[model samples]
Target: MSYDEQGYGNRDSGGRGDDAYSTLGGTRQTRTRLPEGDPGAPHGRRPARNTRSLVMAAGVVVLLVAAIAFANLGGGDNNKATDSGAPGSSRSDTTGGTAPTAPTGTDPVTGKIGSIASGFAHDEQGAQSAAANYAVALGSVGMFEKSKRDVILNAVIAPSQIEHFRSTLDEAYSAPFFKNVGLNEDGTTPSGFTFVSRTTPIGTKVTSSSAEVTTVEVWCTGLIGLAGEGSTKPVSDGWFTITMELSWIDGGWKAVTHSQKDGPAPVSGDTRASSADEIAGAVNGFGGFTYAR
Candidate 1:
């Protein structure tokens, strides 16, 4: 059966419906097309309006646009701090003092543990950035291989939890699970097929923070499957949220715990699916980013 037909995207690595990361876990571009024409409206321009009328119309539009932006930006109490661990709730000290006027994407970190970014800043923004990158590392293609998985865990997980995460995930990504996802029992891609696994963080929110540790939630969407001609498990995208509790240890933020839930996903667009070769080529051609918030 096809990957989508089997509904594998909805399940965890263990093929269970539980928290994917609690089980030990762990893009997009929009192509805009202009409308061809208004079917009901006449093609010719209408008569010019008086300056007063045009000015009033413009003012009304400005107000409407501002209101919409405010609503979408969670202007009011929507992102306020709460004790309840909700999807969007976070500590209210948005940038130490006032909220940021724009999205907070700083320069990418320089230090690396292998290819993963490291040495994040020591602040609230830094905590969120660490969590975001950790989510990417944990959700990477490397996690499927034992050697690479250990490296990723060492880079991202806290020293105290490294062995625990290693052992737990080893059991989670069992040979059966590998075969289920169209990979070999040894967690290697079969000949002539590309196994795609990548995560892109959409946005991040700080749940709570302190001098010692911080909790952050990263909303992410990922692609996973075997990409090749006649493959049953063609590459597919799935949305999920990962919450990582990171501690300041060894002068860097490392994951204390990780958990995941299905999503705060948007409705899927009606874009046509790409062929297996096209998907594989795209995955190979494009490189991933080190996310920061």
Candidate 2:
């Protein structure tokens, strides 16, 4: 069994069906392929074999010619040409080759919030970036460090809820929880281990928005744990839905209240697990973004 990029198990990746599939979370028989044999074996005799072979050969030649023509006409490396229209390309108009026009007529309060929201601003492509950065700010890391935490909370949360969020999170980042996640009492990374706690938003939606408030829900899947040697609780992914009640206040959309719930999660897959070093390097190398709806 193997997991695809989407985290779903692919039975085709090799494994006996008797073994339980990880994604399905149960034992399931694998589908078997029929052994190769002559299609006319069951018939009395083969008919017109040479004619069929000649047709197939001609088809192959035609395909080869077309491929070569395409390769030459594309005027670039074949791989580069294919990759040019991939999802990450900003200019690639995958939505039927038409560029998305900018939205017109912004709300005044929303625009004010948009100003500070600019720090957290991102287009749809940047949703994951926003989620990851916001999650880091909302997580234990932001609460442990005094100045950093203050800035994060002040910038991200609603003015009215700032005090409450700070007080609650302060207690949540107690010594025991820090130790549990392989962090120091003060929430710093332990010796030889890089503590990992980041969220990646799957998608976001604005459920409702009024003059003074916006109700946005960010569906996120996060990676949490320490990545390093001698670590038992290595990094693992989690799925959660975070609902935020944001208020247009003091020139920004501030989170008045937020809550999270587990899942909409998919089954685990059989992909080869990446090493701690790989995970650590990937996280460090990638930069997060701010999201806007």
Candidate 3:
């Protein structure tokens, strides 16, 4: 995959055209309640990808980027979306897919390695679930930090590849990159504003599998940018599909490599962008979920 990890909305910006993403941009997710309110209902998972760190650096940036503008944004299959091929069309809602539900039953993770979810079930379904959740974790803002990033890497990455992945990511999270997202060179969120980035998996497909290795594609939508008054990078949504190559290791599946491509992005929505205050509030108040497939 030739890393095309950038762009959001169906509008032209920085020469990426309407359908393409600019350089790398991403954020964590904002979960809105579907009208039905069923826990089993699939909510949108943010667009996710694993970068050169045996994972993805761009996808990691995306986790802290988006904020939901509507309260009951529906998550549905992209194919089912009747997009008018216009910005702010109904497609954003439909791209999420019918299976893109909120978490249900037990939190899929049995525990956490620092903040990253861990202790996955050891089966095909379990592997898919772990990959789905890991996509969100790998795509999180926390991965920018050292200690937290280390724990997350250990939890989801194959041990043999960890050293290489970590080095790759460290180089990727450059000072210039941090500056673009309005963060200090150290990767800390600035005063008074919230940075958003999230990955919501619209659907998952296991392309091939064996007892030792598996290939999965997680089609996801993501939110990124900043929230709060005077924040220059206001929140916006984008979509992408991530393909992960996993190895069943220890008692779970771990990612050995991954890559990101732009979206099966449906049309952007017409919902008014939330005020920085409101967007910041939702980010601070709402806790992210442990995504399940």
Candidate 4:
């Protein structure tokens, strides 16, 4: 399911689970959790497109340009540094770099906890890698299941923040949220239906970094929903950026806190939306990447 179905909550609880995950706007911003429904529509149908949406789309284009410039300013150097001495470099100088639109042959961490990537290098690129992979894990189908969620949290969260993350997420993925997403209360998809929730990082930018801590922004696009005939929550696309504060702990980069915000999204093209079976088949056929630099 998409983060929207999860909804935002108190800080101690899981942050909001919407298109934009919980956001921290330089201060505490409290948001009430709302189910994924449009109240004015008949039977919670999505509202009709409005003029404001067009204006917003225009703004997103402008923002996308600025973001590209910013990414280019620092992305190249960082990528080269990442490309160079990843294995032995204790610190990488990311002062001037061009943000790569594709992978730069930077090797991902060699460690793994089940399918999760671990054992990241102690540098900026490592932090970015950790953030990207963690975003995938956080936005995956497993987060809906309690047992799977616990395993994921343990693998990605900093040791000190484990309990807080666990409790917060436990409360965040409530039964109501599950029902809203077309999943059973136990987080299982009904018979013959495929649930798809996947996050693919478009790129990563390091906002700040030190030997012990790094803050990275991962631009991501995702698909989430139930894929089957006659499904209310049909699979759809969303774009958001996840802000991760990662700390070097226990020989790996682990998340201390995370925040998300709506795009930087590009305008949608006129491409036809695929059928449910096509979408489901594609999701299953394409295995995800072990994201690196």
Compare the candidates by lDDT and give the number of the best one.
Answer: 4
Worst 10 residues of 1 by lDDT: 1-10
The lDDT-based order of candidates, best leading, equals 4, 1, 3, 2
lDDT of each: 0.57, 0.42, 0.54, 0.58
Q: Which parts of model 2 are misplaced by more than 4 Å?
A: 1-136
Please give, for residues 1-293, the per-residue lDDT of candidate 1 as tens digits: 00000111222222223323111222111111123445467753333336424433432332232112111211111122334233443344455654442555677678989988888887767887787777777667777788987898888877776766566556556776676666788988899998876777787777676666676767778766678998766665656666666678889987765545556667554456687889989978988777754
Q: Lowest summed-lDDT stretch of 10 residues in model 4?
A: 23-32
Tens-digit per-residue lDDT, 161-222, candidate 2: 56655554455445665565566777678788776655555666554444444444556665
What TM-score does each of the candidates earn? Answer: 0.68, 0.55, 0.65, 0.70
Candidate 3 — which residues are off by over 4 angstroms? Answer: 1-109
Better of 1 and 4 by TM-score: 4
Error of 4 at 160 (Å): 0.9
Candidate 3 structure quality by residue, lDDT tens digits, 1-293: 10112211111111122223222224232222113234455753433223222213343344332211100111122112122343433212333434444454645555766665667665445666777777777667666677876777777767766776566555556676677666777888898878776767777766555556665667777666778898766766656666666676777777765545556666443355577899889988998777754
Residue 27, candidate 4: how far off, in angstroms?
23
Candidate whose TM-score is highest: 4
- Name the better of 3 and 4 by TM-score: 4
Clashes of each: 0, 5, 47, 14
1 or 2, which is superior by TM-score?
A: 1
Candidate 4 wrong stretches, greater than 4 Å: 1-98, 101-107
Give the Cα error of residue 61 in candidate 2, in Å.
62
Task: For model 4, state the Cα shift of residue 66 in Å.
Answer: 31
